[model samples]
Target: MAMMPRMELRQGQSLVMTPQLLQAIKLLQLSHLELQNFVEGELERNPLLERDDAADVPPHANGGDGPLAADADSFARAESLNSQDGMETRLGTALDNVFQGEQPTVARLDTHGADSLPVIGGAYGGSGGSFEEGPEGFESSLTAEASLHDHLGAQLDLAITDLAERIIGQHLIDAVDDSGYLGEPVGEIAERLGITSARVERVLAVIQGFDPSGVAARDVCECLSIQLRDRNRFDPAMQALVSNLHLVAKRDFAALKRICGVDDEDIADMVAEIRRLDPKPGRAFGGSTAETVVPDVFIRAAPDGSWLVDLNPDTLPRVLINQTYHARVSRAARNDVEKAFIAECLQTANWLTRSLEQRARTILKVASEIVRQQDGFFAHGVEHLRPLNLKTVADAIGMHESTVSRVTSNKYLTCSRGVFEMKYFFSAAIAATGYGEAHSAEAVRFRIKQMIDDEKPAEVLSDDAIVSKLKDGGIDIARRTVAKYRESLRIPSSMERRREKVAMAAGGR
Candidate 1:
């Protein structure tokens, strides 16, 4: 080896993730809400970017002169071509080919046409109305209801008069959780407040008598006892039943009857009464409002007996670059700094608009492929859902599996059956017994549920029986797999189901 300095030329290639490419990837995965917020932030930052609120102008209206007008024309032409062609024809190449390392093709979005934009009818089976109206009509006008804390605070204010007792009551109320159970023990509260346990107990007693029946109990047993006492039904038998809730959970009627010292009819009555008690009293108040899920794509049946997939225009963020303003700003730039800033803004704005357009198109392309692959599910039911995976969709659409995964995340599809997350269509395949098509785990689960639902009380199907039935139907599944699916469906073991059915039969008589 010689210690010398020499110069040699080398050639190599590497994949670089530019800022704009990263932004495009981020935008593709964002849910509709997140994308809107991101676009709004960009609009505020970039003077050249503006909301595309103007009425739809034909590409020829301005003689297709400026870059903006040219982009509009290209988008319009692309949309027209897409509408005329079938999905299979339009998705001949991967979206990555059109955008990555190539000139991006902007897809036109028709805000008015039913054939292009999502409507409320076909797949949704909704009456004639706009699907984009959202929850603004009556829900927007309604006032917020009182929370559990507020409700309890108001009751504490009126119920407690003595300053010392009121202070203790307030501390106890603060300790109560959303489930209406007192989170802190009386001794801990007393120690924390530097008071006696007796004082805390006294205050807890007074607070428990407040409205909502069981606002300040320490445990489920105490909560049920408080409610039963209020109803003047907390007798010795009911007390015994409440104390031994484990027996009730197991549906051990014999043990419950022996422990409660009541006959079958009496024990049943007491158990029914216990069931009527509110387990979580505070849940009825002070909860966060439920958010409505807005679907990203709409699928409807076409007149030609095929699925018509369309992107929800409402979810699409409509934005555009103001070329006229950019031109004016560029002409008036006083220095290179201002000129560079303006140029950067223009580039960023152009990228965002193109990215949004591409994001919408990518979603539409992937969703169309899913609808095509799961056509049986749409036409029939969950029982017909074919086994699918991210790789299968990615390969079919000529995209990376990671890209397909991101598109399906936080995205939903609406169809005749109902609104479902895009990921819901994907399931592991259960092998077929012979030379037949593999069954989707979801479809197999549905079949199991159906079988159980139709089984007579005398003929309750165990996991083994269910497995045998599935094998008969060409689904080669294991007993453990069936058991796992049954558990996922919230179904109990065969013995528990049999016990429940027998109890129900006796109760019916």
Candidate 2:
């Protein structure tokens, strides 16, 4: 082949991520506290960006609000929220105090059900101290509440035969979710906890009989069966119910009646009795209350029928280039290496300042679009959370989905209702039927939770029943899908729910 030297121009479309742009995108996903820490680090390394102590503070200046002083932590912030410098973290609120003195404690404490080990910030006067007041100047509705696993583990500690049994029980308790149900398979939990599955099953059997009754079972069926055994009223019909939990779950009344050798009337009685067991024995967990997310941005409704969207001032950090060192380095620089280093520092400092500005703009733009999309949620409540997606907000703000995704990832938006992660507002769309308008999946989930809560003990709604109820409100969901949503919400199946009721009744009696 002969090579011909020719100059031609062609055009094509392509996407490339520049190093700086990637950095910017990475910064976007960081929570308020994370970004603040990042900027503080940048200030130490770069001599240009300076944090002001006594001057007019910039809109999002670090340490601007003077942070919650260590001593005033009890007076100022809630245990579930912590303010360092000027940044606040809802999940990691007590970090500063965890490492305040010569003794260093891990800032983030384990939220798992491991008792005996006090919860994170437990010693800082969290449960019974002045710290209960929450952060000063900021209001949070979520009170610290005890978790389900903790309750189960506490009971296990008292009930188990030995240390190994207790250890196994703790492993099982750890496997349970927030609602106190074992979402993980017993086999999987055994492998993870480095115990034999047999040990897990044995200890789990013991745990199920522990106080609160329905704990440590892999599925709702087992949970109920264990509770039933504890009741010492197990019958062939009841035994058949637990053994064929899947059939009972499907409402296969014909088959269940045949298997239990019962008629329609007896079927109703058996089902009712089965329904009276406890599924999540750990749900009665006691300790802290009021767990909630704190938003990074606050949109204040002005008296003038307008809005003032601002970053939570509590998250503003006090960080910047040390003014004295910066001035000294600039004046006394003489060597080539020194000048080059200073030049690099200057570039880094400028980039950091610009990055901070861009960070605020991006967050504000995203949050504003969220407010626009979820105006109903703000005005009404969570039920009004519109069906939204990352692309929806990105398109409205003239950005990319990835950009919006990163922005909403760790960011929180605080409003009059409460603090929620930025992503909570965006939900999958549930197509509307002939009944009414389409709804957001989150709204549906919330509704499902509510419906389950309000159901009369004598009449727990099944998936089909739930579907009918949702249809009345305009949503067309299937029973299986409803069951899926229920599971996702860490809710019990109908049988497990009935069992829980029975256990609760027995306890009450």
Error of 2 at 445 (Å): 12
> Which residue runs does candidate 2 get wrong by more than 4 Å?
3-20, 33-209, 244-255, 263-269, 286-291, 300-304, 328-350, 369-401, 410-509
TM-scores for every predicted model: 0.75, 0.54
Q: Provide the RMSD of all predictions against the true structure, rounded to 1 decimal.
A: 15.8, 16.4
Residues forming the 10-long window of minimal summed lDDT in candidate 1: 54-63
Q: Per-residue lDDT of 19-134 in model 2, one digit per residue for the tens?
A: 55567667778876576567666655565667644232223435434311232223234222322323230012111121122211111111221112112221111111222454
Evaluate residue 110 in candidate 2 and report its C-alpha lDDT on the 0 to 100 scale.
Answer: 18
lDDT of 2: 0.65
